[model samples]
Target chain A: MSYITGPDVVKYACSCGLLKPISHLYFCRYCFQLRCSFCVCHEVDSNFCGKCSENIPSSEARVKKNRCGNCYVCPSCQQELSTRIASKGPVNPEDSKSTPKKMYYLSCQFCRWSSRDVGIPDQSTVTGGWPERENVHSNRLQELVDMYKAIVLAQKQQKDKDKKKQRGKFLSYTDRTGVTAAALRKRIGLPAEFTHPILKNKPKEPEPASAKTEVDEVPEQLLTEPINLMEITTVEQRLLQPEAQPVTVDKLFPVHKQLSIKRSLRCRHCEHNVSKPEYNPSSVKFKIQLFAYYHIPEIRIVTVEPLRAGKQCELIVKFTNPTQHQTTIAFLKLNMDEEDASLDSEVAEVIQDLDQTLSLQEKQQMSLTSLPLSTSQPSSLISVPSRQPSLTIEPRKISQEVNCDIEVPTSSFILPPRDDAAEYDDSGDTHNIQDDPKLVKWRKSNKAFIKLNVTPMSDLALNSEVVCGFIMQHIYTNTVASKEPQKYNHKVKVFLRLGQLVGSE
Target chain B: MSRNNIKILPGALVCEESKLRGDITIGSGTIVHPSATIIAEAGPIIIGECCLIEEQVKIIHRLPFDQQNKENTTPVLIIGSHNVFEVDCTVESPKIGNNNVFESKCYVGNKVTVSNGCIIGAGCRVTEEQILKENIIIFGSKCQMREGLDRPGLQTLQMETLSKMIPNYHHIKKPNKKV
Candidate 1:
């Protein structure tokens, strides 16, 4: 007997006629049925690396080859054997004067065929020269051609399937308009008899008093509008077969127009080809026009904390725009390891409305607090966070300011101890250097301020002090191309450490 | 086994004391070294020219099952030219083609077709129904071609190393022997 805990429980027999726990069953969303592992047959389709294969429960064996990486076979007898580099020198090389020759072993399990009997050279024995083979076949020409053709066909099929699935959904005007008659009339023209009858009967229905009262009793909103029957209906032209009679042309050719009296002229002095030219000579001077000015933002690292395995740290990021013009920042993006590590493609977006109307500079502070810990294990002293914790917008105007703060948990950073400290201490101390009181107190009071000057080719500076590390990212905008902002993003990660004394005074 | 009377055609290799019983047709540009035996019992063994037979290679016509009944045995081993047979290689009723290189100690089963320009690397065992394509390089022999070499996701070199080794042997004629 099994006991059910938590929530309502439903028990049913599997297709294999076995009773299993609910967690062991799978719910098929398409068929709305329960499926167990035993109910369906699983086939291995492909083989991957053993480490990845074990982690991937649904992986199949690689169809191309079944053998593991380390196994090899004897070419002569088709038997599995161990192939290794034979020792060359004597057991104690100092005692023996002769050089040892390396050899390879090929032992057959069935016929007991050994390579030693044949005097074959080992792999290590031949370094530069081409090793010799003993057996050659004469009729293997057609097999190679068939293999190449099959591989090309499989790739083409996969590309077609991917294109079919990549079509995106977007709203269009045709989807909203339900013009059924208009669409049919555009495809096929209207009949002539139906149009003629409507024109002849148009004036006969409006003259009766009873019909006028019925029209007036109808809703005022519906009766007030004049309905155009021609606009509501559509007529399409139909191509009919021509009468079976051949028509003859009266004139074969038409008279051509007389040529005008024109003469081509060439410059006699310069030998240049000349044509009719319009002479418009005004005193003209070229002038350079500048549409908009671009400002480059500055980035600086404020504070960094190398979070120990059990410890937690917070990262504070600040962005300031010291520009004079009001700017609208569009979007901010962060990248880690040359790849977009954001959980979503559109991770951070900021729309800054700076006050450019008045000369007063507006500064907005955004605190990105409580960033989640990265899932990767820490291996070094500086735990490079898999993803950047902060992102800001592209500043629109020059000298407009926006500030953003990112509070990263202390558990994300893990700093490894220095390995070369043994000679300096002389006592072979193995204590964690992060436990020092100075380092702890320094991390508590770590703060950084970044000042941004959004000038033409402006530079930003960021400064911070903390046990962990800090990274600052700056994005600048270009306004030359059709009002679309081109972002030039930059980032820097810095690790902080306390200065140590080299020698005793 | 007269050492002075050993007759080797230009670019043709014959293993030491490899007693050829029946009529054998050896093509031009073939190599057969000493210490390798090619015995043709019932049917004639025809070895095409430009074929490389390495040291200690054995090509016997007699099947293992017919050892007791040697008088009623019928098995023919025909090898084509321009093929590289590595050391200690064995072929039994194998029909090989041009530009194929067999690495060290390759075991060829009965009636296997080794396509042209195929590289059978060191220690490969090819069984029946195993058809290797031209310019196909098999790494670390003992790869049985029981199923036609149509397995998906198998990566192979563009031009086989064997084809590059034996240049001017097929299609182009040149008097050179350097591998």
Candidate 2:
């Protein structure tokens, strides 16, 4: 649990070369590689109002400028404003039998800011139609937008005509003849040109705004009067109403709460979704979550002896196999300077070529594999041809320097597959696999305690932090696309902080 | 550090489930939720009228290290009227003023003096020695301070509803004072 907010004492180098906790990395089953956020394609899966939890369509969200219409945040505190109802007494005492009328206004529980403070009228109904501001220069801006659209259209058409002229090696029958297309159109009682009438003439340009040379003089009252800091608005308060940027606090208005989006991450190499959340705004579950924690063997630092410069220390680490299939864990010498991950790029290229042919087969296999995935994805979330394919981020050299050398043991260890029933069954582990007594200090059901010898560099300064690292090669069982399980070697570089080196006693 | 000497004024609803130690005074119309602790280790604690202390809230009045062995000059920690101490907050402030709010899970150290209409926001820890000005709001994890134009609105509605609902379910300590 401390890994969420604690120091990064243990880090795994992501395929993209970024050092991240194992929980933050995602495992791509198809590519058999770890993908971090940097190496994944992020797409907005859905937009929803955080307050009301109402899903908004992309078109509606665009039109509404991605803000919830009903939910308002306090301009002062930036907290969600709740609508409160106040009851009014009956106007006539004789008719006291009538129920009181209810009026609603927005209020902030944190800052005590209310809509009434800004002179906004209370509404009788709960869903009050809050007043919205229109930009004073919107009409002029609209004219400019339309004019640019027309200009772009004319430019595009001109380019198309030039392209046609260049490619027209063999003249058309009409062009070769004594008649042109325009002349034929006129002869057929149609318009001489099919171009837009606006395009026929140059696009109208809006009147340019002129600046005044003279500026308004500051009021004399400001120089003479003592200022009240309480009356003036702070930078944060003014920024909330960016359109107005009112200096006075009374002019601040409640702003609509911005919409939040759920994002789905896709693996760049395989072009497959690595993580996708469920469509419901309230549900925290994901439809496809390929977090590396579920597949990789987790390592936690159990204990380590006080490190002295050039002195050997015993370091203990606990490893747990999270997968359903047993895996063989091997330690490889850590290489900080170069990476063999570039070889994966060539492999990815081959997969990319296969993906092109796989799509055609996928269309055929769509009905057969309907139960698992890709059948329930929303149209908005589908990968479109217009969007460019995500490029894989280049792996970087592991940045942390290893000050301590870890002795790599020659023997590999076997981790039993995780069993859900083993914890409650109370029955001892029945596995017959033999473990190296010197390497493996303890073994339980699915977890093993491994001991390693580490030594801090002799040249390291006194009290300097000592870092040690090694590459872990594990057997990954791939069961996604085959009737029988296919296994492969997956290498992951892990670094550990083994506390600081002390001077020799 | 002393025997319990609780004095509840008339109209004050002090739940019997709450823990009160040493000398303490609960003013009229004050509501103390069950499980709230008011410890007066150094001296007596005088909570004013209409104050609301919610569950898991701890109001401790222990003396500072330097003052622990010294003769106490002002032995009473006076909390003002209409103040609200929300859930799970720990307040050891020597001085607290009227209309102030100590939000949920916040910690007000002994050195801090909370003035009138001030608010210590949720989860904020203010251990540094400083006097909070009127209407000052200390918020966020960094304990950033911002001045507000007005104090937070009273929790009268919530307090009114609680005063009616609490006595029906839990045992009530009888008011020992008329006012």
Candidate 3:
């Protein structure tokens, strides 16, 4: 089965309340919990252009407004525009030797839109000096932004001043002596100097924006003339060019290509990276990828009998062990009533560890993913403020229904470790092991076909889909470097969507 | 019916490898690259001067099913001058005007009529039964139409260079007419 784009008939309940396919889930080894995209923190790692595949530094991308400098997208069809050259006729007709001058213009081969359509002159150079449009309200927006920034800075300074006043009970030596720098200088027969703090000289306050009472009147032509659908820009097109979203077709200009970003996902509980892509934009590799598909056994439906309502049907499913270690699988009842005590303990441990990591004696404030400490904080502070302990997000309840009952087998089965060379070997079944014929149907290298019996509910309607869920408790051998290979029982809730029920027999 | 029926005017550069069928006439200053095919199934075909038919281009002039049974009378397919059939382009259009460009991998159906200064963009297919107006460009996924400001300029330098270099490596079809 193609898991990448295939319809997900098999899904696993993530640590969060969300239910997702196994391919989308990540297994955090330290915390031993299934993490999904919703449970992880996504952060931008790098920015690059999709057209040229050139990596743009984050700082440079910020300066360029997160757009490629040389590449342009068509304003009409949003396709990448290529530079086309036009050869001009020689200026001096008498001189046959004079070469024709070449001019470049941005043109889209897909939509046949060119810079000349908008009355932009062709440039003499290949990389055309295309004119950039400035936002008409940029000046007013800048003033507003400055005013807000100044207001925030003033509020922060006021808060700091309140904190300093609270700490003023422990007076300084100069205050205790009732002698300032000027008083001490006069007593020592020296020149006087002012003892006022630097904060006494206030910075200039930014002017706030003024709101006008009168609004601009609607144009008269809008009421009389019929609107042309082709000339008017769509909502998506306007959002693409946020600076000057021209309403008319002729006012549309080529936009610089937006840069793409590589994202790194961090596990929310343990703060470990579940998946971290390489910094180089061209490299499609990951530094840390803890996918659940690699750790947990993969289940694929091999064959199933025609399902009928209120009838037991034979279902054969194959399980593949992708890990290097051999594991044992057992069938457990899909019970949603019991809370997983181990999951609760793991979260509590993570919170305690986080508390120890962010001690008030050292780092008073901590950010996620081990972000660097604030650079604006001075090192001379003797006492650190104590903050509240970090709260842990509790594991959500498993919200799923098992309409069908799967007969749990008594005996467990053993799956051999994966061996790459065994695939090429024509010799079959070298390892002789006892297997219950009813439980295990067939066996191969690192793969086994197990038969199951399922009964749909009697009240299921005709042509209604039958879903069956089970708690698969498999023996997981952790191969951490610090400890010996330890085998632990891990339970994963899996749901399988069976075919529609047929007529009652 | 025979290769002897093909006529090449003076200054025309028709490569020997080009596949020509039926009564075909090539005008002066026309360059037909090797592997270009022209089939005049309906009748005689006349190509005008300064036309460039690049390699792998196919020009077919077939009569409609109703008129196929009419004997002793054959319709003529006339392609105007300064038209360029780019590489791998297939044109079954009944008529083509001057300064028209059928870009690379473009396909123009028999029902379509291409007028002056029209450009069928690369990989575009025009199978609809309609006439393209002058300087109209058809491109993009939706086949959006737009008016061109000016006609595409002729590749005189490339034509001059190809005329001098093609005859050295491959056999050339000699001119049968002085005009």
Candidate 4:
């Protein structure tokens, strides 16, 4: 139960050499590998306001600057402000027929701040039409953005012309007939040149922005007057209103609540979604969720005797087969050097082909030189395919240390598949199986506890924690059925933080 | 609206619909609105003058678990003058000083000692055993504490208006003796 919220004492080494708990790892069925958040690609799925739970389309969210249209947060405390009604008594107290008029205003119940306190008038409607402040420099910024876009487009056109010149293969009659036509027109006594219709209608280039020399001077009162910390806005408060960034508290306006986004994870190697959430923000269901906890066998420390330096202690660990098929657990010596040597041998075979594809010169010849694009036409008119992100994650060697030694058992144990009905049935020992009493201590329907001898390192400081690790090799049966239903050995390095060592014997 | 085991001093305006139970004493000039409940489970309670207890406000006097084993003595909850308990607030504080304001929907646990001019903001659950400093205001979702430059002003106008309007709508619990 503590494993859910407490610190992760047991960790599994990911394929990318990062150590993480089982909950943080996702199983990619196509690649048959465990992928962590660092190895997977994240994409925004939807944007919605958490306060009102209203789904805002991505395009509308962009137009609203990723903020909710109707919701607002308090400028002082950032809490959601609720609309409250204030009843104003009748205008004429002497008139018996006059009725009270109600008005609405935004108020932060937590901070006791009312819109009236800030001199904002109450509206006649419940959802008050709050005045929104616009960016003062919006026009200037828009001009700058337009200028940059034009400059970029012009530079792109220039590059296109250069590329066309490099090709120089298009033999248009205009170039060859210019001199011949002039001589022919001279022989006939007529004008040789006629303006092309397309060139006359070309768009005019946009003017560039000019740098300004004058700037605003600092106010002289800032030097003499003592600053009031309460009245002055902090950096965080100013940043909340990115457009205005008011320095005084009086200028602080209610900010629209920022929208939250749901993210979907995709495996980089297979381009398959490892986890994808539903489109609706209110629903917490997932469309695709391939968690490693469901695919791999889970190991837990059941109990361990008091650990003393240089003394062997009995450590009992339970293994549960989460899959529908039975699995055999084998304990191997935690030898990373041997694994690295095997990986090097495999890499030696593929390095030649990898080197050929990794060369920049070869890539350039294959991409640009052979396939020449028609430069006479507008490049924007041609819709080129978007570039796909290539998988570039390289596997790294495991970097970890083990201070305690675990006595490897000679025999391996088998765990039965998990059965939901087994929980209710009182009848036990339905399946007759032979087990080694030395290695297997206790057995349940889907779980089994195995005993091992562990010894902490001697000559160590007192009260130091004992850490140990092992290479767990389990027989995995692939149920994907893409190929033959075959059994394979899947190995993962498991590290555990054992209890602290007592005084040396 | 239990009349037994309750005392309302002269000039105290307590609505007839207000629920009063156990040993409780209302001071002079204090106003307790309808639906306000005052329950003294551990011992008697003594409220000072000019305090305003709003609708649905609950004032409970219950001893803490740690203090239950002490020598058997009747503990007293003393609330100072001019304190305001806003709507739907529950205050179990054993000691409260003058000019303290417990905002709407806020909860003060049995271990908190609220001093003068302290404002417990709305929806704040201050269960941690500690003493609140004078002129301190706790607000926000994070329960941030800020020192106010001055004490909050008394709701004199609202109290006066309520005093004038409430007598016309409901019955008032009269003081048993004249001062």
**Tens-digit lDDT string for candidate 4 (B43-158):** 88999999999999999998799997886788899999999999999999989999999999999999999999999988889999999988878886657665554578788898
lDDT score at residue A36, model 4, on the 0-100 scale: 91
List, residue by residue over B1-179, the lDDT tens digit for candidate 3.
44437899999999999999989999999999999999987778899999999999999997656667988766788999989999999998888899998889999998888889998888888998899888887766556566676787787888899899999999999998876
Please name the candidate that would achieve the greatest lDDT relative to the true structure. Answer: 2
Q: Model 2: runs farther than 4 Å from truth?
A: A2-6, A91-94, A168-202, A207-237, A339-394, B1-4, B15-21, B40-43, B60-76, B92-99, B109-118, B125-138, B142-174, B177-179
Which residue pairs show collisions in model 3? A110-B140
Task: Indicate the worst ten consecutive residues by lDDT in candidate 2 chain A.
Answer: A367-376
Clashes by residue pair, model 4: none
How high is each candidate's TM-score?
0.21, 0.80, 0.67, 0.66
Candidate 4 TM-score versus the reference: 0.66
Please give the lDDT score at residue A10 for candidate 1. 20
Worst 10 residues of 2 chain B by lDDT: B140-149
* Candidate ordering by DockQ (highest first): 3, 2, 4, 1
Give Cα distance to truth, residue A17, candidate 4, Å: 1.3
Q: Write the per-residue lDDT of candidate 2 for residues B1-179, one digit (tens) a residue.
A: 46889999999999999999999999999999999999998899999999999999999998678777877475689999999999999999998999999999999999888899998989999998889899988776656566666788799999999999999999999999775
- State the local distance difference test value for candidate 3: 0.80
Q: Write the per-residue lDDT of candidate 3 for residues A1-505, one digit (tens) a residue.
A: 5754277878888877577888989988755677899888899988999888889999999999899999999987788999999888886878999999888999887767789988999899887778888789888787777766776776788789878887877756787887776878888989786534434443454466579999999999999999856567666567778788787767779999999999998876557789999887778899999999988888878888888888999999888898899888998877777665443332222223213333443332323211111121232332332322122455577776778889988888998888999989998878776889998999999999999999999899889888898877776766652244655567788888888888966
Report the lDDT tens digits of candidate 2 across residue range A1-505. 7754267788988877788888889998876778899889999999999999999998999999899988999887789999999877775667979888889999887766788888898888898888887767779989999999989898888888878787978767895787877888899999886775446766888998899999999999899999866568778878887777879777888898999999999987458899999999998899999999999898888999989988899999999999999999999888676545443432232223223433545433432222112222333454443322345344566678898989998999999999888898777878798999999999888999999999898899988999999988887776785565656667788999888887788
Task: State candidate 2's TM-score.
Answer: 0.80
Each model's DockQ?
A: 0.02, 0.24, 0.31, 0.24
- Fnat of every candidate, listed in order: 0.00, 0.06, 0.53, 0.35
